[model samples]
Target: MRLLIIAPEQIPVPPPVGGSVENCIYQIAKQIKGNHEVTIVSLYRKHLPRTTRVGRATIIRVDGGSKSNYLRNAIKQVKGNRYDLIQIDNRPSFIRAMKQAFPNTPISVFMHSMTFVSKPVTTPSKAALDLGRANLIIGNSQSLKRTLGSKFPAQKHKVKYVHLGVDLKKFHPSGKSGAKPFHILFAGRLIPRKGIPVLLKAVQIARRSVPSIRLSIAGGTGKPAYKAYLRQTAKSLGIPVTFTGGLSRRQMPVFYRTGSCFVCPSQKHEAFGLVNVEAMASGLPVIASKIGGIPEVVQHGRNGYLVGAYHRPEAFASQIVKLAKQPELTKRLARQARIDAVQRFSWTQTASKLTRIYEGHLNRRQG
Candidate 1:
């Protein structure tokens, strides 16, 4: 099968920066190339070495000014070629353009996260209608599928939930042992939707009970003003918070391994908490908010605790304190987390499932 994948415009293929969507694209493309001809159409923001062959896939960077032009060029490329399937990664603007470009193609739109919840101000009803035109829609979590189903009932049958997978080898437990201060880690874009402020407030309350507690925040700041606000909030509360800006994917394992627990207190709009799976894979218990797809990933009390999404700082603080005081409980949950992460969230399994979806579409088209 010949497959063409369209990624979001933030970065081109072989992205210099780190992102979950980019990483997933790279891994899935590499795997699919073994059996199918894969071509990645991405933005040419930075200089790419003309054309590069990754695994068995050929990555083509298209230069364009506006979103329409990007879609125009992409459709032009496909018009001359015979592709078995077209897969577009999540992006409302790109998806809208692609639908216009390839009206009859067996297109599949993969949702990385909910656009409406991610950006509360923007209404995605029209975008969701555009997405309904696709032959199939793939969501990263059950929560995402339900959300989309409720929003666009006309295309509910087209929406399928396929959980994202993690590379177990790259994100496993480090054997190094030694009890240190209770270190909590948060790795994601520094945005309000991520509930970073909530996590900060929770840390402040937890510190009163466990003074040795420490919080390490990794990831780039999307909104400078919000980042500044977070800093001020931390200072006002007298919480020891360290912001590591951003780290490459290669460096993430170190942070995951060193930390005692991972917290993702996202309020809503989070389709799937990829970091939770990554942390669980690294043998660290997770403390995620009970919202969105978090509960589906983190088994409360089994792998980690799930605090109420709308709870105040005291609630989050109490959970942290409980985990800190109960070393035996933490150890049990962390052990199970490691086992579950490795068994359930393997990239090999995810790629295989995706391959089947592509094959099914191609088979139907041929029939």
Candidate 2:
């Protein structure tokens, strides 16, 4: 089967730097390309050619100056081609036009978050019509899947879930045998919903019990003013914080391996905290919120501790102090985290599941 993947106008595919959505697209396409002819259409990036073949998949880059130009150019690029399926990542608005362009081909709209499905991006009525055209609507987590279902009850039947995966080989245990400071790593966008402030407050409280506590905040490219605000907050709290300013895919594993533990104190509902899984895979114990699909990744008291009231600093502080005081316990939890990540969440597993889902849907439709 020939599969054509349509990435959002925001980022470029593999070889070029991208966020979670781009990374997922590149990995999934790479995983299934051996069985199917995979083609990726993504926005233009500097120092990369318009068309290039990576492994088995062909990547086509187009001008993404505007959404209209992006869609128009992307459609024009594939004018004379035919495909068994077309996968559109994150952008719900692209579905209707894509469906019209390739009338008979089955189109799958894979949503990473609730952002594109709600608010200024789309209205309920428009979203319903757009999503209704999709043969499959994939959410990265069960939490996201359920939210999408609740939002569009009419299209609920089409909604399904496929958890995002992390590269095991790339992200593995880098033993910090005698590292001085106990690093609490947080990797994600510097958005309000990420709850960086909560983590800072927690770190401040935990420092009362464990003086060797420090934070390594990894993520970048938002308003600089907000980042400065975070710096100010950390200073006021008298916490030692290091902002790595967006580590690359290669740089991430080093940071994870060097850290003592990973924390995800999200104030809002995370569809799926991909970083938690990545941290687990890197042999670091995860301390994350109990909300959303986070619980599914970080098992409470098993691999890592899950703070119930994520917004409250005390809840997270207690957990942090627990891990800091008990080095042996932290190691044990880290071992279990690695085990869980290896046994449960892997690219091989996610890829197989995705492949099966695609086959099941397309085969059923054909039959």
Residue pairs clashing, model 2: none
The global C-alpha lDDT for each of the candidates, from Candidate 1 onward, is: 0.81, 0.89
lDDT minimum window of 10 residues, candidate 2: 10-19
On TM-score, the candidate that comes out on top is 2
TM-score for model 1? 0.92
Per-residue lDDT over 175-289 for candidate 1, one digit per residue giving the tens place of the 0 to 100 score: 8666789999999988877888888888888888889999999988867888888889989989899988889888898889988889888876678899999999999999988
lDDT of prediction 2: 0.89
Off by over 4 Å in 1: 45-47, 92-104, 116-125
TM-score of each: 0.92, 0.97
Q: Tell me, by lDDT, which candidate is best.
A: 2
TM-score of 2: 0.97
